[model samples]
Target: MPFIVHVLGFATFAQGTSEFMLSGLLPALAADLDVSLSEAGLLVSAFAVGMVIGAPLLTLATLGLPRRAALVGFQAVFVAGHAAAALVPHFGFLLAMRAVTGMAYAGFWALASVTAVSLVSADRRGKAMSVVVAGLSLSMILGVPAGTLLAQHADWRAAFWAVAATTALSATAVLLALPAGRDTTAARPGLRTELRSLAVPRLWRAYATTALTISATSAVFSYLGALLEDVTGIPERLVPVVLGLYGAGALAGLIVGGRTGDRAPFGVLLTGMGTVAVVAAALAPTAEIPAVVIPLVVLLAAGGFATNPAVNARVFGILGETRTLGGAMNIAAFNVGIAVAPWVSGLAIDAGPGPAGIGWVGAAFALAALANTLLDRHLTHRHRRTTSRSAPTAVDGARATTVSLYAGHDRPL
Candidate 1:
């Protein structure tokens, strides 16, 4: 409940706006740069690529830096990237700057995710995560739309200029607010030790689940406009209204997940993924019915995103002591989903089923995520029983230790 945590969210909101604003400006950007739509589309992929690479790379690069310095420095780079992007006359330069902005966003997110926890008690980690994560959802609901309006009313470069200015303001706020402190003392373990911690099978399982859970919605979301137009037969003017409905569902899910995830991580995961699986599979069948498909899409967003906080909290709990690499790796996994989901869905559409195919593809991903969650629980219980076999009394102690783990008894939550 510290002020710094909310400040962290404020900073996230600014960066998130920059991250998603590009989608709305693509047409204008393409025309202005004298490029094709597909060529301009590469900017989104460029950002995703940078995020996937930068999460761990920058975490290692700034391994021992203080939290405040790292955050402010990252924001400075993000601002510079956006500013440079706005000023550049050529498409290549803009693409490179977008990638640079993504890298800065990734590094900032990697540090800030754990930093939010450093200021809170174990019991409140979920609340902290919720506050931090809510910024991204809010950006989709609010900032992206505003940026799109700006681009329509002015120019695409104006949107980029606005991003740079807001990012600079948030960086200034972060510099003024976040106290100076080591990013992570536990990370004092050298690079080799930190890297080795990531080899754990359990961690990779968590990473896989994170990627799958995220991909569930991201795939469908990428093709939503097309599906709404070609399949649902919705008018172009009403598309934003439907998108707003989806964003509302996403924000609502994030809030619910953040509030309940700490006490019932598995339950949250199951319910959320189950909802996504159901809605995703139903989307194609219901596409011809607006009333049916619209609500389903909203539920799809809600269900897919509800698992986010829980999965993130689980990763933090599992790697409580050696979190140096976990946060970065989890972040990398998120970008992996973001970058790959749309591509996979696009392929499915191109292959045969058309826009409706995105539904089945998304459902497959959601079901896989659900299966992974179940497997994670089974493996955890089995591991606990195996570890408790030393002595009868050790069983109680081991159970308590795991209970503590779930309660975030360890510091790196």
Candidate 2:
């Protein structure tokens, strides 16, 4: 509803483009730097590590500054990091630049949702947040492929330069668009309060749910290309086309999640996770069938990302006043899942199961998350009913008053 929403989305697109394009450019980077492929791959891990720690630590370090200022500052650093990567001569320096970019990106992610929600009414928070996330989906569909094409046609360094330039534009746009003021509404908690906020046990459950739900699907997705080629009997040339289908499904899921999340967050989460688990189960059995497996891949991607809006909305609901900290923690949780799940799946593949077994592993993760969600729902309902029964009611007060005025009230109307 607000123009600022698009501004934030543009910034998110710039960041997402920078993040996802690395995979496409990795080969060129490895060749140019005279490094092994594995070493180049570690650069991705290094970026994840930065996000895993930087999101919260940076938020804590800059807790008192106005959110808009923090946003602009982070984007500036992000632009600088990419520019350094573009110009750096050595592999190690480029790796350091990637880490810096990741840290800045994570800090911006941690605050951007909060800022978007702040700009709109409470009811539209999910919708606004989803638009921000769609930037990533669009990156997966367009930016990564385009960057790969650029690298193929010209040089990998050109991709980095393009991202750096885009980020600079986004930083300037954010500076001009968002209101320049401190968040006067949310109380800025002290260090101790922030620590206590992190201590909430229920919040961790929500985080676990978010992480596990993402891992369930990402495990399968991370290896979709290999699986399609080896297990599904699909030709190597068609893998990208199939992957594009998955991306489209993800976009659809994001749209559906955005619309329903504000109305029924838990319901949306349960449905999405359950659907993912079911699709994963179906995948293992039909891995050899191209027609079935192809459709299942789409469904799996949709099911996986469909949980995004609900996961975010539910965490914010649980954290209340500490949403900034909670949002940062949740983003960290998702990145942790992204970093861990694929490795675990690879272990499963090596243990005896073939490529097809990855789907089963994902199914197990989804089921575990589903069980946790059901448990949370049960506990919430039981607590509410218990509180209702024990609460002081109007009838109790009426009874107490009757005793005080019994003689006078003997004659009823």
Cα error, candidate 1, residue 356 (Å): 3.4
Residue-by-residue lDDT tens digits, candidate 2, 384-408 = 4454455488686565444322211
Model 1 clashes, total count: 0
User: Poorest 10 consecutive residues of model 1 by lDDT?
Assistant: 404-413
Off by over 4 Å in 1: 22-41, 89-91, 181-193, 229-237, 392-413
lDDT of 1 by residue, 1-413 (tens): 87878888888888887766555566567678898544665677677778899999999998877777888999999988988877776888887887888888999998888888666776677778888888877776777667766766788888888878888888888877765653345445678877877776887888998999988887787667567767888865666567667777888999899987777787888899999988999997788789998899789888877888888887887766567567888888988887787778767877878878889989999999989988887776666556556435866877765664553312221
* lDDT against the true structure, each candidate: 0.78, 0.75
TM-score of 2: 0.83
Give the lDDT of residue 161 in candidate 2: 81
Quote the positional error of residue 17 for candidate 2 in Å: 2.7
TM-score per model over all chains: 0.89, 0.83
